[model samples]
Target: MPAEQQHCSEKSAVTNSSTHLPVRAEWLATHSEMALDPALPVIDSHHHLYDRPGSRYLFDDLLCDIRDGHNVRATVIVQARSMLRADVPAHLQPLGETEFANGVAAMSASGIYGDARVCAGIVGFADLTLGDAIRPVLERHISLAGGPIDTGGRFRGVRQSLTWDADASLTNPLYPTTQSMMDEPLFRRGFAHLAPLGLSFEAWVFFHQLSRVAGLARAFPQTQIVLNHCGGVLGIAAYANRQAEVFTHWKLGLQELADCPNVMVKLSGLGMRLGGFAFSDRERAPSSDELADAWRPWIDTCIDTFGPDRCMYGSNFPVDKGSYGYGIGLNALKRLTAEYSRDDRANIFWRSAQTFYRLPESSMVMSSSNR
Candidate 1:
């Protein structure tokens, strides 16, 4: 386990030592800031829930962060390949995760956990490489997502990550993807199932692979594709110290994807250790100003390339928690988008995700403070 990926699962604790645990909560307390616009509605478009030996961020941990000051009304939990059924057939195993997340969502919708709705939109994982054979699994996951939440549908999409790199260090192992999996015939055959079912696709790929995503979007013009983590911009490992070269390539790739109208981008996830900013290396926690400054070059290019409507904010919490506190991450997003009109800000903050995931407007409990 990497030091930056501290959130754990039961399996990780046995193999990894305690040093890989997430940054201590006490360390994050070294710098704190009140939410800049506390009343603004938010939908954490991408995040995960898991429990590891020394680290955990289940429902309670997520709710604690929601209450930390941002008006995070709801969140769309992306798949982290957790809580899978051990005994089930390989194709049916992901059903366990959908059941687990939907159960948490039912708990949230009960209103017992305050105004927030966690896991309101569940993007469970399914092996697209399974090709057309994956239809039954996708159907079962959708059925599990059914509950009294909102009629727009709780199960929104699938995220296989597809984060491949020639650098062996960057492989997540969890995804088990072959290089250029998106370009594979079997993957495309499985991907063909999404739009017909009205589900979206979450593309988590490296910056170098943006052209692959654009190819996918062009192939399936009707399917909604979200490019995760600012196209998974990377700076660590073999990519270290070549910031200028990385940015020029990343920006060019983003420009090509921007032309694919079916595609959108998530403007968060810069906090990961893979991002190479090394904010966590500092003696004190980073202020929102520092976060905003460090994130601007990439974020601004994303917003400018995709526009606010085609982009949404995702905290990528717990995964990002290793880099900065939840409140500070969102506060920095607030600082970055302060200049946009109220409507544009609203789209980036919550509405883009709300509409993209088919989550109902009722899920957002706006503060009286207004935008």
Candidate 2:
């Protein structure tokens, strides 16, 4: 028998290692089964690593999470409001994103994360509506990120989230999405600049705005537009009883959006603010299966319309932790995709993200072999 297998057998007979062996074995076996392809590398297409309370989320935090849980070699650090100087353009007020990207680079420099560099292709912030100033803001932010380490051409893109709630009270600076941002000409110009820079655009909006996204996708055929959170559908009060009708409209809107070859859908953040499973008085977290169930129809519709190549899995991390932990959410997504062939599973979870983000082969480590 192989040394590892022999050792496992020996551990089964011993009391101390025997006690721990079952848990280890179960974990290893689960990981092995979850992978359809042992060769394809895994990239969490959408995930946020932040320094919030009661969670391990610094650069090293993410490294340990990736190393301990699965074969995540590289991660794209989406902007989660890092500790940056406050003075910048009003629209570009929260400048902490540059620092966060640099933080990921520093962790890479520490090199304790095996071959796993934080090849964090950043989707940093830029107020594309600023037109002439948009390029300058991007350059300034890029300069902030490039100081200590060679970023490996990892400045992948920008995400100007346009998530508006009709209820005027829903205005939170943390997530700013107004109807005006979508219809404005200057913002379109800002979005258009991305194609010239070879950067992709990440869109975050509510379900009603799916039509607008379809419109934007049609308008900008050159920009690789990624729709976040299954178009941010909300399934709580006011919208709760309308799931069927809402989803049907959403389905049709997504189909239209998918017609634009440049658009992709990220299967993430669905259950976070969307409150079907999170409406309890005590805030009980939904199980992986529960989340997968809630997200199934939307995800399936998106895959059917956009095709698997344009779809990718994202944990949406700490925000999702409000409802499901990273491991749980990923396992849930994996379970939902269990029926797929290994190649298809690989594409949904990892491969498509790699191609979309332009991550090199060396940056990813497959979980099948990790076991």
Candidate 3:
């Protein structure tokens, strides 16, 4: 609750054993037996892989996960703070994440990762406050992704988080709370730079902020914008008796976002807190149905508003992994979308992400026949 400790300390101490420890193939294989395939190619539009000294999200683990996971051909690797070295300048503080992706790209060149490659469409950071400076910041991010460390070279966009909320339960206070960046012209000037480069914009805002998101989408029709985490709905103790009121507000806000053509949504990352699913010792995991119930309305609404062509699946991994395994969250998505036609399912699962991230259909090292 203190300002110094704003981040939720769910799994704070990720021991070396927890990092590099192999997720037994037998366990996943056995779990796979209960999993149903919608027979679609899925591009998890938003997942995070952090690096610890003895961790497995390194190149070897990433490739192995892709090979063992469902029909994934190409994926867009987003920035996490794995490479945030202390010596980098404050303006360039975010570039460390971009550098980490480049490292993933280099290892990708070894040609062992089956058909799924770390498609180079990176969404690094640019401070919207430094209007003119943002352009170069973006340019530097792309350059970093294209450097020798990155063999895949998929630089695509950036995600400047604008989630500022006064409600303590709704956000991590140490990080800036819920403020809509789109409402500010200075930030908009920085945002305007992405259209010409074919780069997309990723947005992280709370449900109350969706109206402003709709406004941003209208202002920048050409700049593709992706909304993360179902507009970040939160289930606070204050709303225990009145869940519907918050959800009602969220539903209406989402409708406004659906009005924007350039804005797409990623149906992930609500299970931990917003969904009111509790897990203490890793044995009391939430079921797929529970996860699906919390998100189905929002996901279905986004699909109806933007259609399946704009909808994409994302794992929100490591974060969600604390509550459920990678395969579990993904299986919940499959279950949530089971009612749709095969073609529609394919679009939501992969085709949309392929076109969105500009990932190649074929791989030079590994063969991705699923696409």
Best by lDDT: 1
Each candidate's lDDT (Cα)? 0.83, 0.64, 0.65
| Clash-forming residue pairs, model 1 | 8-51, 8-52, 9-52
Query: 286, model 2: CA deviation in Å?
Result: 4.0
- lDDT per residue as tens, model 3, 45-94: 77666666633355554444444346665567665555665786776888
Q: Quick one: how many clashes does candidate 2 have? A: 0
Off by over 4 Å in 3: 1-33, 52-57, 60-69, 147-152, 177-180, 279-283, 363-371
Give me the candidate number with maximum TM-score: 1
Q: What digit string (tens of lDDT, one per residue) describes model 2 on residues 1-371?
A: 23333233222211111101111222222222122232345577776655433333465445534543455666677776555456665655545766667667667746665766674567777778787668766666666666212345667778877877677443346656668787788888778778777788898877778889888888888888889877777666577778888888788788778778888888887646454544122234445666678767877887888887888887665455444434556667777777877777777877778788887565664444532
Give the poorly placed runs of model 2, Cα more than 4 Å off: 1-40, 52-56, 87-95, 147-151, 169-171, 279-285, 365-371
Residue lDDT tens for model 1, 1-371: 22222232211211132112255555676777778988788999998887666656688777766676678988999987678888878778888889999989999999997989898899989888989999888888888888323454589899887888897567776557777789999999999999988788999889999888999999999999999999988888888999999999999999999999889999878987788898878888889999999999999999999999999999887777767778889999899999999999999999899888888766776655553
Which residue window of length 10 is worst by lDDT in model 2? 13-22
Candidate 1: which stretches are off by over 4 Å?
Answer: 1-21, 147-152, 367-371
The alpha-carbon deviation from the true structure for residue 318 of candidate 3, after best TM-score superposition, in angstroms, is 1.0
